[model samples]
Target: MGIVLHLKKKEMACVEYSFHVPSLEELVVVLQKGLKGNFADVQVSVVDCPDLTKEPFTFPVKGICGKTRIAEVGGVPYLLPLVNKEKVYDLNKIAKEIKLPGAFILGAGAGPFQTLGFNAEFMPVIQIGSEHKPAMNGSYFAHINPADGGCLLEKYSEKYHDFGCALLANLFASEGQPGKVIEVKAKRRTGKLNFVTCMRQTLEKHYGDKPVGMGGTFVIEKGKAKTHIMPAEFSSCPLNSDEEVNKWLHFYEMRAPLVCLPVFVSKDPGFDLRLEHTHCFSHHGEGGHYHQDTTPDTVEYLGYFLPAEFLYRIDQPKETHLFGRD
Candidate 1:
């Protein structure tokens, strides 16, 4: 519903003579002018964190797609329902109701902490903890009481390198075949300092087979220099081959701001790219309308720019940095 476009310093300067138009088609047209004639490689990166859960679906009781306020624990609101006298919980059935084939679900804890993915469009779900615990407010997932687990989910995210592995398992259950998996590991020698290494060989396997593009996310732990990379990886073909690996991390640099903008492939194609500056969480209105009746303002864009090295490291810096300067 929203998108932010940021052009790195070098890329912005390369297109000094061109202009940015509001529509996606316009952007393509402007870009084509510079894209011609032995031009260096230009890559575009996009990260999508949708406000899949709307109003009424906030809590798990009504349905998996709406919002609700559950009972509180330790003076904090945890999005979990108390085991009623009948001891009935309809969350799983609710998930079945909204499941869509080939749907990708992403979740986080202590903040959008727990996420489940199935190749289907179903109620956005987040499950937390064993039982009988307090919940803490989470940013990316549902809010939980801190007393419930003392931010254990955040710790898991840090440790496993893939925060919501359980959710990924849930998502994989839909296909019956595991999709591409990449794991990054770190050793905490100095207070959450991260030294990351890719554990999945398939991560770099897809390089030139598919048309290269960019999508993924990057977050620096509150104050740590160590950065966690969430690359936007997808495939028209189910397998993760060597053809398109680089596309996922393609144009990571340029550190452009994520802003809401219209993306048009041609005069006839367009869609809204949501951008969040502060946090990657937002709730949508009844009918795909963003920023409606949600508290803490739904972020349209996550931030500006992918890491500069992500872009420069790929191939061409001038081509990717086009509109806004970093």
Candidate 2:
């Protein structure tokens, strides 16, 4: 029988967004923003993989893209859908092949063909460097932390999908609020893109002085945290064109460290800004695969790092807040 590849239509749904911690600066920003209430708070630092060192290291390589340097590789561009094609597989085997840092081989989801008889799982891993570090964003919660009550979004896309991406854009923009007003507007100029604009006003007290492990009950699982906070309307669009793609990339590149930082909100009255790194695997998913040279030594692909303008909107406290306080 000919190979039957699984095909999944892109569904726009709400998805959780999270990232790894790269530096102490990011940590501070995340915490300060999440601990701003009148009650006591709890803070804990636990690496996803205890044995995994914070330093960067090199790993053995494979696949057709071997020519691409380690640093040049960003997140996986296309979604690795588990199609109706099957080969002998195990979650443990895949993890080993990918050389992920942690033992917990979290599975994003199963096949595009279930009844058709295809079962597979996806686990994405990255290689960090001296200048590269992991970070996270706190816009939408996937789960909760069992130990210290931290938010979680393990394999976020598995749950919410692309709409989740839009949700996060609004959530992080709001600085984490339940009723805070968020505005998402469309951009006039589009190369096949949607514009999302958001604003929020708050009067909550700063719980910066609150003690750890205090406040209301929140969902916390094994390094997973979930919050029921919705952001105001931001812009929306179908990410399908080169212009829209470039626009999004430029939007993030210019934001600098801010785009790299996590959104922080406290059950407390006070606010503390903590910065964290997030991963975006949303790569160019258009053309079909080209199965060319089997011999790696026969081909060479050029590599380039395109740098562009950085533009990030600064949310002023006195302006977007209820009582003119940040």
- Candidate 2: regions farther than 4 A off: 1-29, 34-89, 100-102, 111-326
- List TM-scores for all candidates, in order: 0.19, 0.20
Q: Compared with the true structure, what per-residue lDDT tens digits does model 2 show for residues 1-326?
A: 11122223531111111121123333333333332221123232322211111111011111111111101011111211111132222322222222322112111222222221222111122222112322121111222234643322333233422211110110111101122111111111211110000000011122233211100001111111111211111114533444433342211111101001112222221221111112211112111101111222222111111100111111111211121011
lDDT of 1 by residue, 282-319 (tens): 23210110111111111111211111001111111211
Best by TM-score: 2
Residue 44 Cα positional deviation in candidate 2, in Å, after optimal superposition: 4.7
Single out the weakest 10-residue window by summed lDDT for candidate 1. 307-316
